[model samples]
Target chain A: MPMTRLYVSVLLIAVLLGNNACTHYYYAPNTLQTPFLQEQHDARASLGMISGDEFNGYEVHAAYSPLKHAAVMVNHFQVSSGSGSNVSSSEDSGAGHLTEVALGGYYPVGKYTTFSLFAGWGAGSVSNNFDFDVKADLSFQRRFLQPTVAIRGKWARFGAALRFNQLRYVKGEVDVEVGEPDLTIIRNIERASPLFVPEAGLSCGFGYQAFWADFNLNFCNIRDRDDYHFAYSTVGLSFSCQLDYFWRER
Target chain B: MEKLRIALPLFGLLLLAAACNKKADFNYYYYEPADYALISQHLNLPEIPDDYRAQLPTHIANLGLAARPVEQDKAILGRVLFYDKSLSKDGTISCASCHKQELAFSDNAKVSTGVFNRAGDRNSIALGSVLNFSAYYGTDLFGPSGVPFFWDNRAGTATEQNLASMTNPKEMDMSHSDIVSAVQSKAYYAPLFKMAFGSEQINSERVSDAIAEFVNAIGSYKSKFDKEAEKAIGYNVYSNNEYKSFSGFTAQENAGKNLFLANCASCHSPTQSRPAKMKANNGLDIATTDAGVGGITGVSADQGTFKVPLLRNIEITAPYMHDGRFATLEEVVEHYNSGIQAHPNLSEELRAPGGGPLRLNLSENDKKALVAFLKTLTDTELIADTRFSNPFK
Candidate 1:
């Protein structure tokens, strides 16, 4: 217990120290969607509340299987946050949203385990305003490949996923009034992109029949951090509904 | 199998199509890359003129201090840093916020505002009010040999003074490490830093050095006083009997010049290139409240003594004195004319025969003429020089 407490303390200290007052985060990974389907004609839909140090958001996830080993997924996320008094910049508010679609195949390894590989594309926009003087509105596109493994029981489920993503800023509009450092940062990102980011996630849940509740944690890191500000961690709570035999019956 | 193979390639092509690379527009007018390019083009760092490399005085040269010519690249980088408000903690204040180019690099405010609208304690001094800063203080030196900085002479060198202003709670309110990180995080600074220092590695010392180079290059040698003095170079301008008045000057201006040479030149230097004194007590108050240099040394004898600034561009840099107590040149001249307080550490030059503050009793015309002569010190060219203007678009 003492060791656990010490580790927690160190992690908190690292987090607090790493996030200086001047740093502005531009991106955070969404919660991993793990639809533990066992056979053909299976489907699941879930809604999650996402939270992080700089943002609070919501996500919608839907997954379906039409053939024996084929699956398709779609996800949407929206997040908004405002500047606290501790923030050094005069940023008044910020918001961002992303929607993605993926097509992949899943295989049942045993009665309780499944392995899946997915290829996806996502696009999003982020906007930040500073006391009406400087407004940054940017749009970005992302292409990613994700692999996931999951375990399921009558009443419990566990899952893990790793996503490799290529992120590129597609378009942007920044107010001329945006002063140095911020303006320079925007120009740098535009010139030095597209960035490769890798994300990892873990989730655990309890279920009975068709309904389930899950807790998720995810993290992302930029491979080449050349003047980019991305949130490293996110935590989410999801409620899901599963319809395994409904499509088979029809 | 055929359908799946076609679908895979089709999906890949779809993703590739996302790379339209549409350029961003600012207010449907300006593009980011183009703006940066335009700014880069405008800042064609001009070479420093030879006249700016004036000879160091014998006393300063004897102390191993030499006039270092300003490098164009370093000065250009420093100019950007000077105007960049991002150096402040709140991104609202910069060195140029107080020291403006049009006002002879001085603030009109009695005490300038800093980050978060915090009020400063002392009036902002003009950068090259009387003499070029490098000629007077010797840039980059950080010890007792060089003249100190600030109204109180609290900082040792230009770098220390820059750092002090950056970190002051009422000023920029940023740490050295934070400033370095801020500079490093900015992409446009990469080229600037590389140009100035041969690499993009940024540090607080380098930042200060660049700003010092830019500031040291600010010279005000084209004033009317300088032109008039130049014509009197061969004549015995110092001796009243042999010296004929300046040919360029009107009768009234020459009268004012004569009064200034007799009274103010003891401390302010008749040549107008350098001040005769670094710091002195002008008896602004009988008992010192701000303490001035005495605050730093904890010495009572040094009480009320403040840094003596050059009088160049005095006509425009109003709200004068360390605390900005005087509002105009008339008020400033009045203070020295008849209102010098009897402070214990009053400057010897301002002492009367009875050991009190010397009152320069003069007629109304004499005061007006003195004011007129001070106006001759204004350098219109320096204030309008494009090399020192803001480079940002």
Candidate 2:
């Protein structure tokens, strides 16, 4: 019974992670494409919205099958969010924005499943304004690789993916302008070791005719050189249209 | 039908995620300044002067007393709570009832009277001046090794001390919940609490924090001694040998200062170099009924040991000692002069070379000089500062 309870707990955690919001500042795993090549020249374009506790953003994705067994895909994501506050302005606000781009390939595994891989890079910047004319800014850059697998039925699809990322903090500075002595603190983070981030994702979708909508949930565990680990999660919904389907006769 | 099976679960998950609404984003700006004018008008709070935020002297900082800066809003809120009688069960007593600012924040009574005029066990200790009690007692002085508060040192931080007093049967005679409800019921507390903590959630911890801030801000650095010392040797007079001569003092006052530095400075140095290490059995009695620190520790050597109170404004804080047995500073000085008892656990400083009670055998003039020097330590500014005075008036 205890083992059963443990299994249920794990399943619940997985479901929660799968339904969480997007990674506004961090790398997230790419969603799986179940049938990589439905036809020799199959092409699909998707627009998605990602939402998380820390960020809200959008993603654009395009995939085209050049061969009967292989397909190429490209995606772009942008997210922005804010937190904290500023006392002088009577505004408590700190904001961050992230931009990421990726290109990948997929290979059909069976009649109903496919495997895909992607490599991506992202850049993010955050700024905070505090009381007494104090402002802090931080910039980050990261690279990631993801592998995924998916199974597809006539109207539904289920998939999972894992993303491995390396992150580097580019710059962090704080500028204070109060009273006589103005001070600017530029942190030396160049010597800081890169962080290793491991991410996992779950995706599901249903479609009718030429349009399809899907949900993707990604969870990432980031570990710094000091071995401190932090976890972040993001959830996204994507809408896509198979353009060739409408052009071809039934 | 098949779509419904997958749609319901997914819908439920989305609802759960939205319900969580976890605050994970980094906030860029923080600290919204409260409407101070509104708070002041509602609570009858006085405006804090720029001098109230004065920096500690370099000499005092060199003494290793850690600094705990108090926010102005928090201190103002704390002042209200300090004087509010609603903190007591019967609405008759507050923290300031015993720790009056005029008497260096110590009660003139031997032991302070609590709710229902109940007498406490130990004399109330002075907690005034620019010295940060929380920094001294909670962190720097003896806090690293877990020193407790009060005469017996049963509590730890100022927060713990306030909570203990509030819940003690002999003190405020109110439970933690009762204190919270009382503050919550006061309409004036709403804006003050919101200004201090960014919320109006009246709880015990926030109450303790505000009170501690006010207590920490009751500093007194504008004494005659401070002026004389600063003029003679500048601000960094902690280790200046020239200033040790008491250059600006009168002949008798200088003589008394020299005597104090020679005899009492080991435990009561104004710079706080050699603060009492835990409690010491100050040879108060051969056998004490009040076990003091020993009662809490359950150790034989600790029996009759009590914390050494700071002597910042000792002149007005009389009725001295843990039990407040001595009524006058002369009598208190005379105890060290010739009246030390031969307790087995007598502090080593008061022990004779042959292991009996150490006697000063001082002349009457020397005793008088010592008393005169102690009076110089008084800071009239602290006693008269409207910032530390009751705002209810």
Error of 1 at B101 (Å): 0.7
Per-residue C-alpha lDDT of model 1 across residues A150-170, encoded as one tens digit per residue: 998989999999988877787
Give the DockQ (2 decimals) of all models: 0.07, 0.04
Q: Which structure among the candidates has the greatest DockQ? A: 1
In terms of docking quality, model 2 is: incorrect
Error of 1 at B77 (Å): 0.5
Stretches of candidate 1 above 4 Å error?
A1-250, B1-67, B139-145, B240-243
Error of 1 at A133 (Å): 40
Under CAPRI classification, how is model 1 graded? incorrect
In candidate 2, stretches whose alpha carbon ends up further than 4 angstroms from where it belongs are: A1-250, B1-42, B47-54, B64-66, B139-142, B145-147, B234-244, B270-274
Compute the lDDT for candidate 1: 0.77
lDDT of 1 by residue, B167-247 (tens): 999999999998998787777787677667978799999999899878887878778877777666666675655446888
